[model samples]
Structure formats: structure tokens, C-alpha cells
Target: MPLYYYYFGVLNATLLFRTARWRPPLLSRHAARGCGHAPSYGKMAARALVQYVVLRGDLRREPLSWPLGALVAQACHAALAVTHAHYQHPDTAAYLDQGGSMRTVVLEAPDESALTTLAETLQQNSIDHKMWIEQPENIATCIVLRPYPKEEVHHHLKKFKLLK
Candidate 1:
């Protein structure tokens, strides 16, 4: 009933019909004149149908990591700062996520360069994971780690008489 069925029937006839074999075989010749041999009409039609069906409803779009340059920049900045702090600490190492956020990699590096290297390592890993980086500040500073912890943040605020 489908158009494909008709193509398949014609293909079967060309391949198996007794009279067609005896005839000039123009259809077969046309199908085989080039490309070494022509593929079966049925197969070609089926392939085309499959391609059409598979592509249906599919809309190509840019991948998320296309804007990674922004993330890279943020990661670099945070990494630099974290590395600075981490350099002061003899124990804990610092790292930036591929998404360009900082986190403490405890029991890790002993200095700034090591922490920066760790951040770089995380950036590379983020590239491998195909994630886009975003700033936590966009949501709120609560999410961003200032150069100091809450207590330190408060201590600095006290200088401005902002902290009670």
C-alpha cells in the first residue's frame, strides 16, 4: 500500500522476472551503468525513508561548551586568587571547577603554583567533561567565596563598622 512497497515490487521483478531477463534489460542497465553496480531501488528507497524518518523533528543547535572562553576567563581569575590564598597555606590546595568556581582541594598542594596548577588541571578536566562555566555572583555573593571566610569577612567588615 505504501509507495515503498511498489518500489520493492518493481525491484523484485527486475531481479526475478523471466521475461525481464530475456528483454533488453534497460532498467537493470540504467541501474548498473555507473558506480560499478546500481543498488536495488527498494534498498535505496528504504535508505532514503530511514534518513528522512531519523532526521524528522531534529533541530541542530550549538553545543553548550561553545561559550567556554567566558568560563575560562572566570576560572583563570578565581584560580589566581585561590592560588594566592593557597600559597599562604602550607597544607590545603585550591582548585577552580571547569565551570570556573573555586573549591578547596584539601590535603593537596603546599603552595600557590601547585594550587594554580590544580585549577588548570580542573579546567582541562572541565573541557573533557564539556561543561559551561558560569559565575556564582550572578545568583548572589553568598555563592561566591570571598578572599576570606565568613569570620574573616566579618572581621574586615568591622573595619567599616558594618559588622556588630
Candidate 2:
């Protein structure tokens, strides 16, 4: 009988009964026109927007040996910076509007040189991204691209493996 349970129960009942006639405001236009069920993964994947984060792997392995938390923070910093820079873009808006469905792929660049090269490629291709340079020390730590249709940017990133 907690307040949240009662409210959730009522909301669930409302949705269950009215699903065919009412759609949640957050659903995409295509979804709103369909049966209440979620879209199939294949269909979703075809148009899915994704943000890509590339972190420098060398920092975790050797000479630099940055702490795990610091690397994570670098990725976070780049992601937020680029998102803010592109907040007005349609893809970015839609990506943010997905709420819990937002997707991000974290990949690894072997070292600072690889990261810099990737950033240069992204820039040459007119892909917008933020490369985070850790302050004071001026070390380039990570790069995060704004949300884009997966197909549009995948080729530029296919060579990089996911950060394990």
C-alpha cells in the first residue's frame, strides 16, 4: 500500500485497458500509429541513433596508467560536452528524447595517436565530435560523437573494438 505502488498500479491498469486507443507521448510517430507493442529490434536498429565514445586504451595499460575512475570521467566529460554542443540538432534531440532507450557505444583507441587520428578523420568527414583534453596536463583523453544514425558513422568507427 505504499503511495508509489498504488499510483503505478493505477497507471498500469490505465495503460492495459487503453493501449489500443491511447499512446504514450514519448513514443515515436511510427510507434504511435502501430499496435501498442514495442517495435521489433530489426526495425529499431535500422534507424537507431547512437553516440560513440572512444577512450585512449594506453592510459589504462602502461606508462600513463591513469586510474579507472579518471578514464571514465574523461569519457563522461566528452559525451556531455558534445551533447551540449549539439543539443539543438534533430538527431541529438531525438536521441535525448528516447529517455531510457538511448544507446552509447564505448570503444577503445590504442593510444593518443590513434585517438587523434580518429578525431581528424571524423572532422574531415564533417562529423561533429568533442575530443576531451584533460586540463593543465593537456593530454587528449577521449572523443565523443554526437548522436547519429548508426549507419552514418559506423564505417568511421568499425575498426575500433569495444572498450572491455
- Could you tell me every candidate's TM-score relative to the true structure? 0.20, 0.75
| Candidate 2 lDDT, 1-164, residue by residue in tens | 42222454444334343456544343455455563434444555578999999999999987888999999999998899999999767677667656568999999999999999999999999999999999999999999999999999999999999999
Relative to the true structure, candidate 1 reaches a TM of 0.20
Q: Where in model 2 is the C-alpha error above 4 Å?
A: 1-46
Model 2 clash count equals 0
- Candidates' C-alpha lDDT: 0.28, 0.83
Point to the candidate with the largest lDDT: 2
lDDT tens string, model 1, 74-154?
A: 444544454454433311111111112323221212223433343354355431111112355331100112233323223
lDDT for predicted candidate 1 compared with the true structure: 0.28
* Residue pairs in clash, model 2: none
Model 1, position 117: C-alpha lDDT score: 45
Q: Candidate 1 regions off by >4 Å?
A: 1-66, 92-164
CA lDDT, candidate 2, residue 50: 96
